[model samples]
Structure formats: C-alpha cells, structure tokens
Target: MPLLSYSRSYSPTAADVGHVIRVECKATKRVGGGVLTKTVDTGLVLPFPPMPPRRQMLANVNEERLTPRLRQIGVFRVLTYNILAEIYATRQMYPYCPIWALSWSFRRELLKRELQSYNADIICLQEVQGDHYKSFFAPMMEEWGYEGWYLKKSRESMGLEGKVDGCALFYKRNRFILKERYPVDFNELANDFLKQVQTEYDLDYQGPSMAAREMFLSTLNKMRQRLQRDNVAQITVLEVVPANNEMVARKSQSGPLICVANVHIFSNPKFPDVKMWQTNMLAKQLERVTLNRNLPTILCGDFNSEPSSAVYEFMTRNHVPLDHPDIQHPPPQLANIYASLDLEHNIGFASAYASVFGAEPEYTNYTGAISRIGCDYRRSLTEALLLVIRSLDRCGGLRMVHTGDADSVRRAEGTPT
Candidate 1:
C-alpha cells in the first residue's frame, strides 16, 4: 500500500488535510485515540509533487495542526552542504571544485545536477562566498525554482556604506513565505562605525579613508565583531506572515514561525579564538530568541569543535559548573540545542569526515585550494550529520528532515576533510 501521500486527492479542502493524512497513514498504534507511529516499505511510494511545486520546502506551516500527521508520516529530508564554490569541479575528480569561483562554468552545472538528484527540501550551506551568490547560485536557484534571500554577516556588512562578504540562504519559493527581515550589525549604523574605528583603532590617515591605516583597523575590528557574531546562530525566520501586511493590519495571529539558521564557526589550526567567540555569539542569539517561548529553531552549519568541547557541551546541555572559566559572558538564557536526549537519534555527531581523510573539505568561500573543499574541512556537516539533526529536537523547536547517509555518496562528489 502507499505509505505516505499528500491530502489533495484524499481531502477536498485545506481544513481537511490533517484528517486526510491520518486516515491515509493507516495508523496502527493504540495510544490515546491513535497510534503514535506506522511502518512502510523502503521501496515504497515516491510521490513527486507537481512542477512549479506549491510546497518544495515546508518552512512555513500550521505545525500545531500537522504535528500528529508528521509523526506518523514519512521522515523529513534535509541536505547540509558546503558547496566548494571557488574550487573547480575537476580539481579532485570529486566534490572539490576544479576551477576558481569566478571562472567555474560547466563544472558548477554538475554540482547543481547533484543537488537536484538528492531531492532534499531544506539545505544548509557553509563557506559560500560572494561570487557564488552573484553568479552561479542566483541564476541556478531561479532555474531550480527556488527563491533566495541572503544576509551577509552584519559585522562584514556594507549596505549603503560599502560591501563586505559572507553567507546566504535559499529555499524553494513555493514552499517558504519571506515573513520578516532584520539586519544586525556590530554598530547601530555604518557612519557611527566609522567614528568608532577612528577613535579606537587610531586615526592615522593616508590616500582615501579606505587607504588610511585607521580605516584598515576599523575594517579589522568589524571583522572581529563578525567573528563574535559567528558564536551566535544567525537565525533567519521565514514564518507565515500575511502577504499584503494583512495580519499586522488586523492585529491578529497570522501563523506559525519556524527559524532556520546558517552556521559556520572557525576550526582547528586556524584562529580557534575566532571560532569560540563567534560560537558563543550564536549561543547567545539562540538564548535571546528561545528564552520566553518554545519557538522552533533549527541551528545548522559547521562547528569545527566536536561533542566534547565547551561549545558542544553547552549546545548539548551538559551544563558547566557555575564558576566555569570560559563563560566570562553571562550564562545564555536559552536552552542548549542538543540537550534533549530523546532526539539523540537525530544529531549526527562524530569526527568530521573532512578531517578523517587527512585533509579538509573543499569550499567555495575561499580563494585558495584548501577552502574550496570546504573552508574548514574537518568541520564539514557530513561528519556530524546525525548529531546536527538530532540536536534540533531540543526545546521542541527543530526536527530532522533527513536520516540518510552521506557515506553512500561517492567520494568524488566532494573532497573529504
């Protein structure tokens, strides 16, 4: 029998979706008035949604109504990628890029093809630099039926002031509603930043302010802020909001909000200090958001450290002693993301695959060969895939979409860290 199916053919209206899904599940459990779970064949139904798909990624949904069905439904799938942008596709006969980001043409098409083959709804990417977004990614996303909204690291931000480089997030337009937009910079505004730099870094001038020593120091401090920002999760929420600003206009409950963060922390050998600061920053951000309520938040990306470090321990809820040394800042108000023992099955924790092969993963964010495999190869998501997903269940805010394995993918797909 068909194990999982959408409600359209089974239900006549949107309100009837849950009822339809439950009925279709053939639920077998006798808990409460229903079964908590069901079983299906591995080679069972593979239903592909119609093109111009209405819901390619389920970022915005009425989760309260759909939770029961989801538990009984098929596993949600997610893909965590650090697409080696600057690296050429042919470079390693694997995932590491063969050409530079600026000149990578046909090779990138191969990467896109692989992405489609995976058929994942939600994807998390790290070390994705500026060129990928401007060239290959922007157009390719359009072609693949995805709507893209990217926010650069605020510390590195240059909007209206000037430009700096960092990260981006993409989701299928049909599946996500762009509900809110907020940009956080180390400084309130860029001009204030200029003066702050002038005072702090020392006001030494030269050709243009851009060429002045003080200007360079100002840039350095801003990057330091970005480094700290990395400590905290850079969460972007694409929750349901009335498209015409109707909800706020009416002052009412609009819909559910799901938060998706794109994480990329520093790694070993590089500036470990930078990683710790930024990671702490991410933890602090999560604390601010989850303190008052159980808002669903999925923090995904590359953390160079393993499950044993203070950062990992903090995320997983193994609380440090009250007088722990590293916690110079206040204890974060948020619950550790990986603390929920129940969801341990989802957190894909392990030594990163990139680090295992005596090298690192290829990444697109850098201009050099090592980064093309993945900026911090030892921190590639593939290594901790299970731990990453399992940690989502903490606070009942995030859930794993995929339980699949990257090992199944050929070694040539990308460089192993």
Candidate 2:
C-alpha cells in the first residue's frame, strides 16, 4: 500500500494480509450533475479529526506525509466501541432488522460504512468477536488499505456469550509500521482480584451505595475480561512509544506522536476506589516506563467515573501527591493529554452518547443501560462509535495547511479555519 504508517501483526494469519480495495463515491450534490463519483484510490482518508486547527491541518495532509506527525509515515484511524456483544444480535431480532443478518452482514456493513466515512487508517475496536471480525470486517477493511490487531484472549467463561467485549486494533498497511504490542493481562488478573476483593455479602452489601457497587463489581467479576487499556499515558512515555516498539514509532523518532488508550472499565458500584487505584497503577507504570524521556501521551477511554473522581484528579495533576511524596508519592510524571496539547482553553469535551444521536443512523449493533437506541441496537453501537470520533475532534492537535479541499464523505460540521 502507498499509505505510509505503522503496522503490527502479532502472528500473521491469512486474515492479516492487506488487499487494495477501491471505493467509488458516486453522488449528486447539484454541483457535479450526473452523480459525479469516483474512487478514493485506496479508500485511505482522515480519521475522526480533533478540532484543533493544527490537528485539522494534520488530518488534511496527504496520507503519505502524515506518518511523521503520526510518527510512522501514516495516521492510525482507531475506533473503540462497546458492541453489547452479550445481547446476541444473531438469534434475537430487533424491530427492523433480522437477527443473524444484523449480527453478521448488517453490523459488518454498518462498520464498513463508518469506516468508509472516516477513511480511517488504523482502528482500535472493543466489544468485538474474533470469529466474526476475521470472517467479515477484515476482508472489507483490507479493501480500504490495512491489516489488523486484536487482544489475544477469549471471553468464554463469564457466560457472556459471543464476542463479549475484547479490544482489537486495525492498521492500514500504508499508514503503519508494525510496532510492539502489549496485552493488558486483564484475564490473568481478574480472577485473583475478584476472589480477594469480593465482599462476603456481594449482592447484599449494606454500606452507602455499596449494594449497587456490589452489583457493579459483580459485573466486573463477571466481565473482567474487558477493560483492557485506557489511553492515559504520561505525555512523555506516549511520545516515545516508538522507543519501546519500533513499528508503532519511527526508528529515528525524536519522539512519538500522541498515543491514545481506548479503554472501557466496568462502571459498577463497590469499592469504586479500585478503579482509581487501577488508573494510578497505570499512571505509575507509564511513569516508570517513560522516566527520563519526553513523549506526548493521551489516556482516553470510557472511565465511567464522573470527571470529579480521584482517577480524574490524579490524572489531571500528572499524578501528583495529595500529601507528601514519600507518603502519597508524587504521581510518577504523567500529564493529562489535553493539557499536554495546550490546556488553557477547553482542549476537549466529551458528550453523553445520547447527545450525539442527532438523526437516527440506518443500522446498529448494541446498547447499554445508559445508552438507548433510536434506530436499532446498532444505534448504540453507532453512538459508541462516534465517541472515538468526538474525542479526536475535540483533541486531535493538528493545524490546517490547506482549505476548501475536503474529502467528500469526510466533511466536518465546522467550516475550514
């Protein structure tokens, strides 16, 4: 692929090979009469762009040179969505779509359509099934310009049937240089943690809101397989991701572009403090990893915690000590990603999933209790999908180098700066 970027292949499978697919965008917008349409060469377009004019400029740059800002010759268009995999899009039918078709053909098509819209390079997805992705998403994504990456774990025991919620990363062959990969090791840790943390009366705790938390932790205990990695890295370590792994980072990389962690932690009630602790662990670890280095890092994910939580406080303060360094310890050396990008103004803001469901999309895959569907279960999927895009738009630190030249399907609500 002519697309320049970082690509990663854990253990190449028949599915990992990249296929050059042509996307012919035929349409009639009055300007070019007879449905003026054409191919996008390789279908490689900008991903969910952040609002910063600089990032916008980066998004506008031709795919080839994007690698430098992306620090890998290409940009990585990632998508992190919770598909509500347990809901079984196959056997059960929704109001408008068939079960199997919704799960198989239609859902894949929905993802394909979204992928087409973004011209996304690499996609980091959650709530996916291993079987279905290989069978469907891979082949389709290949035509666009890329390979794939998925967590090496299976969610079989939780009784949360189907793909249940796992993380996967896809790469456009042209936009990526395969780098090192890390497994969150959640599977290995969940059981032990649950056993140690489970309350005597798990479903019947009598503490303040602890009963609900008990239910929440039960879900974590039940679905501990999920919540892999949230994108909170010390700006320094994230900036040097190239050093640890060459593929994701350039060989001569003075530093790495921003590294994003798309995480989804279980937002149940219990010693919710555990969640913050985990964040702290991650923060401390990133500090250890990037000590003595300067790299821009971004930790983004559905933390389920209101922005006022301890994790939020710790992350924002660069993990500084609330007390004494020896006592509470100065938070290793992590800075909030948006702040790193320039924190004076609203570097970014996140919308509740409902707020973005402007007009109903045609199809969807899943929905959570907090998320309702207007079109189909896929509506939830669609909404979740937009979260990543919204994140990018709010914070993709790029500037506009050119104007009046926008990708056809890549139109943003805002006019060029």
Candidate 3:
C-alpha cells in the first residue's frame, strides 16, 4: 500500500506558537481476506506570525560616537547570505527539525524579514533557487529600490534536470550604479588545463614512465569532470554614486569605482585542491576584469573552505608558493578585510566574528531543535546571521549613509562603485 499523506494548519492564537498540532490519517488495506487499518501521525508547529515592522536597532550606545569618524570617508554596506534553498531542505539533511517546520512556506517570510533589516547597499546571496528568484526575491526586492541579478548553474553540467541553486547579486539602486558585470564559471579553467597539459606532453615519443603518464591523464579527466559542476561567481563593477544633493556639490574628481565579486566556492572538504583551483581561477578572472588594479574590491560569499585553508591564505597574503600542478599562476594579493586589522601583529582571524568580537566563531548555519516556535525561532536564526552583520557594522566595514566631503568621493564620467 502507498504511504499515508498528511498536512497541517496553524492555530491563530499567540499562545499556540509552540504547541504542536498532530495530524492523523487513516489507511485501510485488504490482506489475505482480512482488513488492516493503520494510522500515520504528522506533527506541525504554528510558526508564522504577522511580519514584524522593519527597524534598525543599533547594537551599541557608543555607535553614535563613531558616526562622525565614518563621515570622514564614504562607506557602504555589503551583506553576504546563503539563504538555504527551500527545495533542498530534505528530511535527511535536517533530521532534528521537522519537515513541516523546515518548509519554505514556514521559513520564507522569516528569512525575508531578516534580510530586509540589514539595509545593506550590496547584497550577495547564495543557494537562491531559480523559481524563488523569479517568483519571489526579484519582484519583492524591486519594490525596495534594489536591482537583482542571478545566474544558475547549467543543468547539464550539474547533471540535474531542473532548476539548480545559484549565486545572486543585489544592489541598492540609489547608492550605486552598475557599470559592468562578468559571470565567471570555473569549469573553463579545466579546458585551459587540458590544453596546457597537451602542449607540454610529447605524445609521439613514448617515455619510460608510460604507466605514470596514463595515471596522470586519468586524474586530469576526473578533474575536468569535477570542474564542470563548480559554482559560479558574479563579478560586478559598481560606481558609488552620491546619495544626496549636498554630496553632489562636494563630489571629488576621482569617484570611487569598486569591484564587488560575489562567489560561492566549491564546498567539499576533501577536495582542497579543487577549492584552490577555483580560487586561483577567480583571482585570474578578477585581474582580467579590473585591469586598472587600483579599484577596491570586495569578495564575499559562502566560500566553503575554512579560514585555515590554503584558499584563505592565498587570498590574504602577498605571496604563496604555487607548487600545485593544477595551479598554473600565482594568485594576486587580495586583502581580507577581517584580517587587515591585525597587520602589525600578523595574527589573522578565521572569521569576521572572531576578528571583530574577539570571540570564537559561533554556528552560522543551524540545524537543530525548535526550542520555541513563532517569533522566537525566527529571532534565533536572524540573530545568528546578524552577528556577522553586526560585526561588520561595528568595525566600520559597513555604513548605510554616504558620508565624507565631495572631494573624497571618486567620480568617473558616465561610470558606475
């Protein structure tokens, strides 16, 4: 017999938030001239509440003191979030959280409210499913004066038939103008690697290490297959525009042009080499995009590699030994804004939370019990993600307003930060 199916609804009382509503369905089957009956139980929580009023709550009373210092230079906020794709929330992945509690219907509003609270100028998002992008995020963000750009992984490369998760970039329409956008796919590097290998090898002359040569070729083929499914990066060059008329009068001759590269790198911990390869490709691509080299760049995303990984070291340091065969070129020196604070001590932190708060990194991604339902559960998730946002805000890495005199503003004719 087919498995029994069940559904649930929430009670509208504030007190009903945490209470579980159990749904039972009865199924009957005939076996060996006997009737058998079974009951299936499904539990659902009343998690949704009216959308809270959007507000920005300052974390520190002393934050007001820093406002003048921030005004000395123009600043803008960039927020990166991996809004876990709704379709991928399978029961197997989140065993502790009930499937009903984890449904997109239950989580979307909470996620949207939390994201809107940041009020960041440049927002980078990962794992945004295609349908949700078209039906939800795009139209909704447009209402808030933000333009959204998205690129999904090709289904053929990923071997998935339907919509695949991809990276998204959203910019506040008023604060910045989008100049150029380059969508990078790391898979192209694999083809380049193949060409390099072919040119370096002497196929006509059989060498003494024929067996070793075949083994190397086999590994190359495997790598090529792996690269085809690698995550993509959306590199956008934006010109920071003056937000108000007062700033326009003081605008400087050299308006700031910032290159914001948002990427979700490869995730598998076992494939450190692949991560390095992806990072290297990203660095090369960035160099090509920003030919001037002086444009301040902000690279943000869910780079699956940790702070201790080679990928992290390469991005932050001025130089590193590029001994790996797959790494064809040395990575350009890119500053990790979190680590830039400890330049004198040379003690780099693993995350923004550690760098700013001086505390061990806390869990950014949670898959656990829903201790309290409704707003409490929503607050828990929002607060955890906001910790990073808070750190960035406190450290002066992000600011909502366009501060500083016009002379400090960098302006380019017909250009866009």
- lDDT winner among the candidates? 3
Candidate with more favorable, higher TM-score: 1 or 2:
1
Worst 10 residues of 2 by lDDT: 336-345
Candidates, ranked, TM-score = 3, 1, 2
Residue range 1-417, candidate 3, lDDT tens digits: 222234444333465455554444444455556555554433443655334333232222244545433443266667878777876677775665556656887677777766787778889988888778888889988998998699776544234333578888999877777888999877776677566655555564457387977765775566566556558889898876754663563355334566777787776555655676676677777767664554556677766654445665666552334443323322221111112111111111133444344532333332332333222213222222221221123444432211122221112110010
lDDT of 1 at 94: 37
Quote model 3's TM-score: 0.64
lDDT of 2 by residue, 263-341 (tens): 5444443423445545554444444433343323334354544333444445544452433222222122221111221
Query: Which candidate achieves the best TM-score against the true structure?
Result: 3
Q: Which parts of model 2 have CA positions greater than 4 angstroms off? A: 1-78, 86-102, 152-154, 157-164, 187-260, 269-271, 319-417
Ranking by lDDT: 3, 1, 2
User: What count of clashes does model 3 give?
Assistant: 13
Candidates in order: C-alpha RMSD to true structure: 19.8, 17.2, 13.1
lDDT of 1 by residue, 138-219 (tens): 7877788766555554444334332334445666554455564433342333334335545644534434455566546655
For each candidate, what is the lDDT? 0.43, 0.40, 0.56
